[model samples]
Target: MRGRLIGQTVAVMAVGLLAAAIDGCSRRVTPEDFAEGEGATAPAEMSPQQERSSAQPTGAPEKAVTATDPGGNRNHQPGDKEPLEGVTESTPSAIQGGDSSPEPTTRVSRAQRTGGVAERPQGRPVQGEEQAGAVAPQVDQSQGLGDQAVEATPTVAPADAIPIDQPEERPQLAEGAAAADGTDDGRPAGASTAEPFNPLRAGRAGMGPLRSEGAGGEGHPAFRPASTEASHEGGRQSKKYDPIAENGPIFVGWPKPQLALVLTGCQNGYLEPCGCAGLDRMKGGLGRRHTFMSELRNKRSWPVVALDVGGLIKGFGRQAEMKFHTTVSAMQLMQYETIALGANDLRLPAAELLAVAAPVDGKTLFVSGNVALFKFEYGMTARYEVIRAGGRKVGVTAVLGKSFQQKINNPELEIIAPEEALAELVPVLKPQCDLLVLLAHASRDESIALGKAFPEFDVVVTAGGPAEPPLDLAHIDGTSALLVEVGQKGMYAVVLGFYQDEAVRYQRVPLDSRFPYSPDVKLLMVNYQDQLRQVGFEGLGVRPVPHSRREELGAYVGSQKCQSCHEVSYRVWRKSGHARAWRTLVHLDPPRTHDPECVSCHVVGWNPEYYYPYETGFWSEEKTPELVDVGCESCHGPGEAHVKAEMGSDLALQRKLQQAVTLTLEDAKKQQCITCHDGENSPDFKFETYWPKIEHREWEDE
Candidate 1:
C-alpha cells in the first residue's frame, strides 16, 4: 500500500511539473515548430536512351531478322513530299493528317485602306482553308517515305522522281503497337519491351546484376531544372544550357511582341523509335513533347508559336494514317497554339486536317496567299483563319505543295503561285505582324524567290527538295535565312538558337556517339529495370524460360553460364546497348512512344514480332509495366538457332555466329543507323550520328 501511494504521488508531481513548463512556454506548439513544407521532390529525369540501359531481359526469344531492318536510318536533302495522310487506299487504317501567311499589325487609317488595295475585314482568314472542322483523309506511304496513296506492299521505288500525296485513315495507337514488332497487322499490343539481356539466371524483374534507382533516380545533385510544369504535371526542371545569351531576341527572335514562330516536322507522321528526330509509327509522340512544352512557359518563359515544314515520313507505310493523328495529340500537347498546313500538307483532305487541329486554344491562323485545294474550277481558297502569337497580331497563310499542280489526275485543282501571292501582299502583311515567318513546302530555291520578292519578310522555314541543307547557314538567294533539317528515322533532336544580329553562329553537333551521354539515362535504366522484371522485351521468350541455349552454340559454349563460357565476348556484348535494346523500348512512356521509324534497334524477336517495340499500347494489367534494357541477342544471332548448331563443327559456328564475321564494319553501321535517320528523322544527323552506331570491336579496343 505504501509503494503504490508513493508511485501515484511521483506521477502527480511529474504531471504538475510538465504543466508548469508548458504554461511558461509560448504555446503547446508554435507555428515555427511545424512549418508547412514549401517544396516537394520525386527523383531524376532521364533520356529515352538512359531510360532503357538498365532494363531486365523479358519478352520472347529473339530471332535475328535478315530481311528488312526497321532501323534502316537514312539521310536525304529534304526529299520529295510524302503521301498526304493515313494508310494506302489498298491498306486499311485510321486518322488523317497538312502549310501559310502573315497579317499586318500597324494601325492603318481607314482612308488609306480604302485608297490602296481592296481592304478585307480584319478577321478574314487566308490559306488555312477547309470547311471549318472536317477531318483529314488518311494516306499511307508504302515503301520508303514516298508519297503513296496506299500501304506498304514490299516494293521499292526508282531513286529518281518521287510521287506526292495520297490519303487514308486509321487509329493512331495501332501504329505504335504494330511498329513494336515491325509489323502492320493492326494488332493491339503494348509498345514497351525490355532490351535482350541474360540475367545471372532470372530471379525477379529489373533487379539486374547491380542495384537500381527509379527512372527519377539519376544522382546529379548539380543539376537545377526550371521550376515549372504543364496543367497535367508536377514541377519539371529545365535542361542546363551553357548560357549563351547575346542581346534580346532569343531562339531566332521567337514570338516577338506581336509575332510568334513555331517549327515542326519533328515527328509529324509517326512516333520514331529511339531518338527525337523523325516520325515513324506514331510512337515517338506528344506524351513527352506535351510534358516538355508544359514546362517551357511555366518558368516565366514567354508563350511560343508553332509551325510545320513537311516530310514527317516517306508518307506511305502501314501506320501512315496514324501519323496524321499526331495533330490530335499535338493539339493536346500544345493546347493553345495555331498551326499552318504544309505541302504534303494536303496529302490528307483539308476538312479532316481542320478537325484534328480544332480543339487547341487561340484563334486559328492559316497564312497562305498562294496554293489552293480544288473545289470545282473556282479554286476555293476562302477558308484559312487568323490568330495571335504574343500580344501582337500575327497572320498566317499556308501554301499547298507545288506537286498539287502536277498530277493526281485531278484537273479541278488550280494551284496558284506563291511568288505572285507574296508580291501582292508584302506591304499589307509586313505592317500587320511585327515579325513574319512562312511555313512553306516549296524547295529553298522557291522560298528564296519569295524572300527576295518581299524583303519586308523576316524568315521562311521550308520543305520539299532534293539537296541537303548546310550545317551552318540557311542561304536563301544568298540571304542568311535560318534553315534547319531534322532528319527521318528518329536519329536526333536539336535546339536552334537564332540571334537578331547578322553575325550568328550555328553548329551541328550530332546526337551520335560523340556526345557525352547524360548519366541520367543510364541511371534510370538501371533503376526501373530492376523494379519491373515480370514484363518482357519483344514479348516472345521471357526470362523464366531460361537462356541455356547459349551453352549449346558449339565450341562457342565452351563453358558454363556467361561467366564461364565465352568470357571475353560475353563481357563485351553484355555492356553493349545491343543486348539491352528491346528493354529500352519496353521502358518507354507507353504506346504513344513507340515509332516504327524510331525503334529500329529497339525491337525484340525481330522475325516474330515483325515489328520492333511491337505494339500500339501495352494492354497488360492496368498499371503493371515492364523493364526495357538492351539484351543478349541483339547483336548476336538468335540463340535458338545458334544452340541448334551443336551438330556442326567450330567452322559452322564461325560461319553462323562468327566473331570472325563476314559483315564489314561499315556495312554493319549502315544496316543499323544510316538510312532513314538521314532524311527527315534527325534535322542534325551528321557523320557524328553514324559514329555511335558503330562500336569498337574488342580487339580494336585492345
Candidate 2:
C-alpha cells in the first residue's frame, strides 16, 4: 500500500510540471506588438546627431540584436530603412532571447526560463524620459514595409513591469490561468500586456507561500490533510479546556444573593500547576484560586463563605507534610471558614495530622466526623461547626467514606462508618443553622448515598468526580438536597448562592488565566521553596535507592562521559530543551531548584517516576554538578558499566552492557518519555511530535 501511494504521488507531481510548461508556451508575440498599446505613435525621422544625442547610457553590456528565428525571411521592401548597425526587431521575445527555430510560435523569455528576473542595467534616463504615460515608439504603417523606431528603456521599471525578487514570494502560475486577481493575467482590468509574463515573479506583492495543515518539513510528521471537524477539534485541544464556558455561568440568570458558598478541594498535592507547559495552558493554581475568591469578597462585595473537601497532598513524606502546612496557610489567607480531611490527608502521622488541623486564634482549622487523631476527638478538629454568614447560621460537617477508609494505614488513626458518624451529628446540627452543609470525602455513589440518607442537609460537597466538575447540580434521588463534586487538582471551584425566596444558584468557576496571581499566595509559594531549601534532601526524607537493575546493568555516569565516543549524539542532546531543564527551574518565579517535586524531573540521577533521587543520582548542584539537567542516562540505563566495558578489551561484556543501555522507540513511548511528560506537567506532550525535537539517531546498530 505504501509503495503504491509513493508511486501515485510521483505521477501527480509529473503531471503538474507538464501542465505548467504547456501554459508557458501559449502567449504569442511579434515586433508590431510593442506599438499596440494606447498613445503609441511613430517618432518623426531624426538625423544621426539627434539620434545619438537622444540615446541614454543604460550601462548594460551592448549585444547585437538579431531576429528570434534565424531562418525567417528578411526581404527589403521599397520604403524600408536598412537595419541599424547593432539593432534588430523590437519584439518582447527579442529583448529577452527566444527559440533558435524558424517557427513563429511564442518562446518563453530568459526570466521565465531561469525562474528569476533578467539583470537590467541601471543609470539616469535621458531628458524627456520623465514624462508620465510616455508611450513606446511605434512603427509607421504608411511606409508599406515598416519604420524601425529606436526606443530607450526607462531607468525605473514601471509598476506593471517586471518586479524585483522577494525572498518570501508566493509562486505564480503561467499565463492564461486564473491569475491572482482572477483575470487572464495578474493585472488590473484595463492594464496593458506590455510586461511579458514571468512565471517566477510573485503572484501578488507581500504574499507568502501557501501553508497546508501538515506542511511542516523534515523531522516532522508526514503531510496529512485534516478535515474541517478535525481542524476544529485540533484547535480546541491546543488550548486549555474551559468548563465554565461550556457549562454556562451558574449565577447568570439569578439575582444577587445574601450569601455565596465557595467550595474547593481534592488538590492532590498541586498547590499550583507545574506551569512548565506554559502559563496560558495552565489552570487551577492556588495563586489563581485566591484571585477568584478575592474578587468575590472585595471586587463584587459579596458575603462569601469558603470551604474545602481536602485530599491536600498526594504523597506521604516530609515534603508533603510541609506542603500541607503551606497549603493550609494559603487557604487561611483566603479566609476559608472550614476544611474537611480527605484520604491522602489521613496518611500523615497522627502528630503531624493534629499539628496541621490545629486551630488558628481559637477557631477550628479542620472539621471531620469519622476520622479521629490518636483515637479520640481533639480540639484541632470538630465533628461539626456552625458559622454565621449573611446573618444566617450555616452548619458544616465532613465524613470519610468506607472506600477511602481502606487506603489509610496509620496506626494512630481511628476510622468509623460515614453512616454512623453522620447519623449521630445530623439531628443536632440541622436545627442549629438555617442551612446544613456536608463535606463528603468519598466516591460519587457514596456521596449520593449520604445525601439520600440525610436529605436534611441543604448541600453535600463531594470529592470524587471528573477533573473539571459539571456545572449542572446533581440532586439526591428524592430530596431537595444538592450533591456537588468540585473536581480534582484545585483547577475549579463551585459557588452556591443562598437567597430568601429564589432557588439556590450554583456556578462552576475554572481557575483559568483570567484570574491574576495573588500576591499573598505567591509569597507563600516563595516561603515554601525557602522551607524546602532549608530542610535539604535528607530532611525532606529523600533517600536515594539503588537502581532496580544495578547489579545486572550499571551505575549512572554523567552524560559528559558519553560524549567521548558519541559526540554527535552528545551535540544533539546539548541543543535540546532537556539539556537546559535545570536552568528552567532556576529561572522559575520562586526558583524551584530546591523543590524536590520539580527538581526530580529537571536534574539527572533522580527517578522521574517517583520524584526522588537514585543512589548515585543528583543530590545538589554543588555536589553533583555533572548530573545537572536531564541527560543520556535519563532514558537509557546507567552508563558506568557500559562506558567501562567499551573502553576495556572485554568484547562480550561490552555487548551485554550496550544491550542493557539501548532504548527502543517503543519503550520510550510507553515508559521513558511519559515519566517526565506526564499529564499534570506536559499536558500537550505527544511522542510523535516531541521525539523529533530531541531525536539522536546517530547509532550504527539498528
Candidate 3:
C-alpha cells in the first residue's frame, strides 16, 4: 500500500511536468524544421559503378532523447495481463535503493491525425462511441501548424495502478462477407484467420501472418493503442455514425477537413492502360491516378497525401529504364511524398538504384529502412523522413522485403528484418512526428508481423507478393495499427479517409473510364517514347533474345512467309488483337517502337535480351516481317524448319510439317495464350474466354 501511494505521487508529479512542457512550446515544429538533418552520406563522386562498390555502410543514430520507459527493464512474459494503453514507467534515483527522489510514470498518447499530436487526448473516442465524418477546419499545407496543435492533457494514474485489461479480441467478418464497409464496430472488416491469400482480389478479404513478440507471463507491458475514433478537444462525439452508402457519392458533404491517403503498388513498368480492357473495364495507370487525385483535391476539398508502396518498375533493363523514368516523372506530377523501394527496384545494379533514388525535383523521397549499404549500422534512405501535408507532420519509413534482399546478392549490401529495423527506428521517429506511416514492401504475412510487434505505426502500407484483392484498411491484431496493401499492376489506388474525430474509412477507387487521362502524363509518355527512339531501338524494335531459352527453340521465318502458304491463318492473325498489338505501341501517346521491353510483348519470338536459336528466325522487323506482330511461329515452333519441310519433297519432311502444324494448334490454348496474356499484361485474361475471340478454323474459312 505504501508503494502504491508512492507511485501515485510520482505519477502526479510527472503529469504536472508534462503540462508545463506543453505550456512552453513556442511554435509548432514543422516538417521543414526536421527535414534538413543527417542521413546516409551520398556516395562520393566517382563512376556510378565505383560509387556503389566503394561505399561503406555506416549507422548514424538520431540524437538520443532520454529513453521513456521506467526502470529500463519491463519485459513482459506470456500470461501477463497486457494493458490496452501502453504504460511507460521512469524510475527516480531514490526508487533504485538510492537517495534521489522517486521518478514519475508518463503515459504518452497515440497520434490521431496525419501529423497532428495532442498533449492531452484531444479527439479520442471511447469504446462504443458513435462518431460521424466531419469536415476538418482547413489549414494551408505550408503554414498554420501551430494554431491547430491540440493541448495535451496528462491522464494521471499511479505508476503501479495501470489497468491490467486483456487485449480486445479483433472481430472477424463471416466467410465471404461483403467487404463494402468496415465491421460492426467500425474497424476494417477483419479477415478470416483461414482465408488463403488471393492477390487478384485485393481490397477484399485477406489475412496476413501473425507473430507474437514473446512478451511473457504476467505484467507484460503490451502497449495498448489510443482509441481508433477521433475525438474533439471537448471529448464529445464529433459526428454521428452515418457512412456513405455503397454507390453513394465518394465525397458528398464530407463533414470537415480530412486527410486522404492515396496508395498504389506493384506498378511493374505498366505505364499505359492495357487496351485489352476498354476504358470502362481498364483499371489502372499513372494517367488515371493523376486524374483521380486532381479531382479529389479540386472537387472535394480534401487534403491529400499520396504514396507508392513500391514495385514501381518491372525490371532494370533498358526498357524498364524508359518506363522507370516515365513512372517517376508521373509520380512527381501527382505529388507523391514518397515511394518505397521494392525488390524490383533493387534488381537494378546498386548504382542505378541510387540514381533512381536521387530526389526527383525534391518532391519524392525513395526509401527502404531495412536495406543497408552494408551492415545493420547504416542503411538505404534517410532511415525516416517527415513531410508536411494537410498541415501536419507525416513521418514515413520503409522496409524492403527479405526475398528481395536475397536477390540483391551483392556482398556490399545487407538487408535486415523489418522488425529489427523498426526496433531501432520507430522510437526515434515517434518522438519527431505527429503521425507515423510505414511503406512495407514485403509479403502479406511479414507486414502483419511487423505491425503486431510495432504498434507505434499509424499506417502500414505494403506491396509485393501475389496480386490480391485490395484490402486497404486493416487493423493488426492486438493493436490499433492499420495495414493496407494495394494490389499489383496499377489497377486500383486505395484511398484511406481520415477525419479528425471519426474512424479512418478506406475504399478502392477504380481508375477506369470515369477519370480522364492527365495531359501532362500523356505528354510525358510520348516524350519517353521519343527518347527511346533516339537511342536506336527504332524501326526493327529493340527485342532482346531470351538467352536462357536459346537451346530449346527454333526461330525466324517472318509472319509474311507463313502467310504465303497459310493465307487464312495470316488473315486471321491480322484481324485478331495480336495483329494490332504493335500498333497499340505505335499509337501510344508518342508511339514507342524500339523499346526492348515494349517490343518483346508486341512482336513475336523473342525476349528482351536474345533470340531463340534458329537459322532463319526473326532478327529485325525489316529483315523478318513474317515474325512481326505475334505471327504463326510465336506459338508454333519457330517456322524455319517447318517452312523448309513444307518446301521439300521428302516424304519425311512433308509429314513433319503436317505434324508440327497440328501440334502447334493443339498447344495454342495452353502455352500460347498465357505466355503473353499474363497477370502483368492482361490481369483479366482467361484463355477460355479469350481464345474464341481469335479462334480461326481453316476448314470453316475455306
Cα lDDT of model 3 by residue, 54-116, tens digit: 111223221111111112112122222211111111111112122222122222233232333
Top-lDDT candidate index: 2
Q: Evaluate residue 173 in candidate 2 and report its C-alpha lDDT on the 0 to 100 scale.
A: 24
lDDT value, residue 234 of candidate 2: 20
Q: Which ten residues in a row have the lowest lDDT in candidate 2?
A: 204-213
lDDT of each residue in 346-462, candidate 1, tens digit only: 455555545553323433433345644453123233222344533333444545445443523334344566666555555565455434555566654455555555544445555
* TM-score against truth, every candidate: 0.42, 0.64, 0.60
Writing each residue's lDDT as its tens digit, candidate 2 over 438-522 gives 9999976688778878877767888876666542343444444566778788988877765432234455666665566789999
RMSD of each: 25.0, 32.4, 24.7
lDDT of each: 0.33, 0.60, 0.50
